[model samples]
Target: MATVWSVTSPHPVHPLAWLAPHAARRRAAGLRRELRPRAADEPLLDLAGNDYLGLATDPRVIDGAVRAARTWGAGATGSRLVTGTTALHAELEAELAAFTGAEAALVFSSGYAANLGVLTALSGPDALIVSDAANHASLVDACRLSRARVVVVPHDDPDAVDAALAARTEARALVVTESVNSVDGGLAPLHALHGVCRGHGTLLVVDEAHGLGVVGPGGRGLLAEAGLAGADDVVATVTLSKALGSQGGAVLAPAAVVAHLVDTARSFIFDTGLAPASAGAALAALRVLGDEPRRPDAVLRAAAALAAAAGVPAPPSAVVAVVLGEPDVAVAAARRCAERGLRVGCFRPPSVPEGTSRLRLTARATLTEADVALVRGVLAEVLTLVAAP
Candidate 1:
């Protein structure tokens, strides 16, 4: 016996129709982003990237990545707690903990994920999060996902943080901030903030993404430089992509915190582990940083030189922001830099406060005197051009 049936498929819907108005609004606001993939060998004076130690293209780092890929394949197959965790990942974690002077460490696939993982895991319905207004977007998202009461204090204001923390009725509070304000290139008052947190019985979480490659002795990072490393109450998260010129992030904290994260951090528990090549490259880069301790100093010197040439005060880390006042003006300045074969970063509204759009210049340890002079000269012209425009 046979049976016959008639079937029909439903009409499809346009999935992105609602995005048209949103995209139009963004365009009107001068916030539309365009992707421009860089060439492998673009000849330009570079200042946009966060390769603070200039290790991204180093022979040793490249060799390490190549060796790792050859040994462990190209991708991490599963989550960290599953088939993804490799010997390379474990070694990298150990080395990072030792280097940062933390009792223990955990690694994530990216710095953004690390921030999200740590903040969300540490905070809950019973906790409060006092965060700096100028922290990275990752931390902001983390706070939103934490399901904790979040109080955002003014940028670099430790007193405000203390006040927020003191006012909280929660049993647990976490004070979160960046070692260096990413956009403004301002250094945080970590010593004062830590003091405030300690007095309030709050734990401090510092993101050292920028500071790790360009600050402290031998690029051990600002927490270590501030003598706060390995402190039971302070935890630090650093990105391997910046100074190590690799990819991934690590959280350095007490052993208990590390263990707890291993058990409960959803991001780490579910996300694929960091690729072996990144782990290998990071380890090799760490060794390189140890051998070339002067690289961080070189980066700072370059930042100072860039700031001086721009007629601004020297920035604390490798980031130097040149305020251009308007989105179009900042866009013009960045365009001028590109015209002059200088690749610089252009950040507008949302990245910086409204009406304070600017060019973000990052210093690399390998930049030469000639490169510095060229950047200075080009930026001087850019400043004048934007001023008149």
Candidate 2:
């Protein structure tokens, strides 16, 4: 165990010295992260991002962003209540609600803020929040900050959710989960969970950050696929950064919930609004998705193919997790892939479960047959290296 002098002791150490032991432990455990920046023109094939629809570099999306920046300037200028909330932001919200079959929508600067906004706004003194154990970090943070009675249940277990809801002493309860888990490609039982919510008169908040633009008919989202869109008790949050290939988020819910969020939700009221460029890009991507309805299927097909190449089961979304038991093994495999001109994601330590370090490979609609072959070859070599003594 590491020892430290107490602040009230005769000889107390400096305030920053406590961080040294934490840093040392992280370094020894291979959990220290270097926020490395990559050059735009790096010669590497990317399987590391959440750009499922491949719109990040689409000419139409670029044109939309450029036009918005030219028209509205680069920044949101201030919080939405102040100089922000442009016509483009309102347009994006309306389009998102219409496309997802929701009654209303509200935009935020990022997905993390959207999650924080809704949870903090909807929760109060007599509220209960039941969260899934494998929920995304954003949702977890929201739960912690909500000031409500929180219970963490098993991953993908509707019975657990129902039990927690039934046992809650608070009359108003909210169950939180991700439509598709971030670490692996496992999906939550949204329909079943919704039924529990309805039965217990609770609200279900699904984070569709990983599902929108990748999981429904025409990529409307998982809620639409489950026939739960526009439901009174269901609220969904999604990031434009993922499938839309932009840089913001939105909450899809009933008009009443949206209105309440606008009035409250400190994160939304205080934080800078979504940039006009991101809003325009997301709107264009939504239109492109509507025009090219086959984009979702293309993403699913690519994910399935990559999973087969990795000798793994087909995942529900674009993420195909290659689990390597240790951080060292996972990092080694990622480096080997990079050496072969392929960029794969390395997830280790607190990002995932203790023994579930992995390579999080995302498949895009734009991947060609040649690109698929190259990825397969690189992954196969990585697996071999990881398996060797």
Candidate 3:
């Protein structure tokens, strides 16, 4: 005989009570997160932010934001299909396409939305999506929401992608990958992936979120560096938040693909347009990149210095991950850095895999020699203390 379970409480239980145990479990696992807001002018040396080019505070960028706000108001006011499409948005889209060597471009409110828009709009039930195992969270979520058969191959493995594409029976196929791995700072083999994609007659989607303003010649992007930009079968997505030091995203693809996304992408169709201020700021950032072509080199050099200080391989992009192998250790190390007047990023699962929690240090083009030296000293000291028995 089986015993039947019954609620003994006379009143109804709280609907959110079930979340308490999960929160406790997270605490036990050292994965509970908290928000710590900073002041506008904190004295700490910041190495955790994604402002790769350090243009967020540039006078030109700020002026661009102000100008756009004055002209078009602070908000977009409506979706792109409605009243949200401003002249600034059109100009930004045109410039982005020209800079990245794409036939056209479509701006979104964020990089996440751009990923979601392109993936969901391009693939469907009868289509197959080949994704890299280490793709960003946005790409993973996009794959899940695409309603397509998704096969996640090993990270940076073109042969695995080729095999997956070869084995798929769907009439249409899409291969999505990140040009740079956001967590580990690994570079994808764009040329090889594109070759495999061409062989399979599949569309290649490269997320240049971490690569756009830090990789390629003159910060065009990884796709442009590989000579695949503007290819009819290729598409790229980028965020204005990272190296651009702005706040938006755009999809670079053939004109037809942009048209398709504008029509069919639910994220784009239902979501509000990118803010006018963000569009203006991004446009100004692009111009700054054009004028200051060496900014990307500065970022890479800083990343190399930081990686050497951490005794890790030089990262290909602005992100330098120093793995400490445990969430508590990473968190404690970050806290120690903070105590030492250095602010860095601490990432734990599910941001990274179990046992690979790390300090995610971002390099900025504006980092002075003194700043780098101080960072080196602090990293050496903190990492040494953490390694002590």
Candidate 4:
């Protein structure tokens, strides 16, 4: 008798298999995404990363990381609830809450995890989540994972959020939005949304990834600038990766909400704690920002200059998006800038909510006048090259 073996078919019969065709279409449209790592000593002028304050590699930040690593081990051994929580984590959380003017704060491994922890922990089957159409992918995924009735309202439209909440009479409601849109660098109408949420008795969660270091007095964040930081119904999630130039995130809210998350948020309970080094670095960066109040002004000026030179409108925050009219055009423009020793971000569909492809440039406080001139020149050449045909 011959031995028999079973073979499985590679193809699936479900409609989801059609995703291959969609992916191929995206490739044909030059919307394929790829990552290219930079060399440690790369000479290129970087305008792609979210290091708004240019402190990621600062000497003080590096020293903080070194000190923390020397004191604590490199990796957190377990989830924060178990053996992972350290004195550094507690100190960072306390300082962050005080700095952001919130009653309590919970740190997570990343901003994505922070969003997930907050949305999933606060909302459930009986909750209605009204989200902005232009929100980050993390928030969108959180809404989906929360098992809540999610209504995606028009981008930055407080009236739409109000109507959505008004229609949901009995459910616990959450209004979620980004303080500064990642793609276009446009500021959201946070004040108006706060009013809408207040009227509807809804909890408002603001993702301040881009707004923290570039907006408000002393770079406190959009919520602080809008005078909503300590509001009982409002919560904020922010990334330490951007302005803080670290590698973690934090959710700031009322003490009760923070306590609730510690008990109920699966992401917080199961995820490994943020590295001790990142916490120390972020704390040092925050202190530096507090001492040097003129950093945000420098970033804003650089952004304004770049926007004007690229023939794009100035961004309200530190990001300046240069529209290239089409997907292939945007890719080509970004490539040209890269070739010219300038690194810029290329945004296409899916990443861009409006489906308009553009080049996303992040302005840094450390960018000098000469660096700004180089950026202007490279952008001018790339735009001209793309526009020619």
lDDT of each: 0.90, 0.92, 0.93, 0.90
Q: 252-301 in candidate 4: lDDT tens per residue?
A: 99999999999999889999999989988998898888889889888898
Candidate of highest lDDT: 3
lDDT of 2 by residue, 249-315 (tens): 9999999999999999999999998889999999999999989999999999999999998999999
lDDT (tens digit, per residue) of candidate 1 on 222-336: 8888899899999999999998999999899999999999999898999999998998999999989888889999999999999987888899899998887878788878888
- In terms of lDDT, model 3 sits at 0.93
Q: Could you estimate the TM-score for every candidate?
A: 0.95, 0.97, 0.97, 0.95
Clashing pairs in 1: none
Off by over 4 Å in 3: 1-12
Per-residue lDDT, model 3, residue 311, is: 88
Instruction: Pick out the ten consecutive residues of candidate 3 with the lowest summed lDDT.
Output: 3-12
Model 3 Cα lDDT, one tens digit per residue, 1-389: 88464668786566577899999999888899999999999999999999999999999998999999999999999999998899999999999999889999999999999999999999999999999998899999999999999999999999999999999999999999999899988889999999999999999999999998899998888888889889999999999999889998999999999999999998898989999899999999999998999999999999998898788999989999999999999999999999999999999999898999999999999998899888999999999999998
After superposition, the stretches of candidate 4 with alpha carbons farther than 4 Å from their true spots are 1-5, 8-23
Off by over 4 Å in 2: 1-9
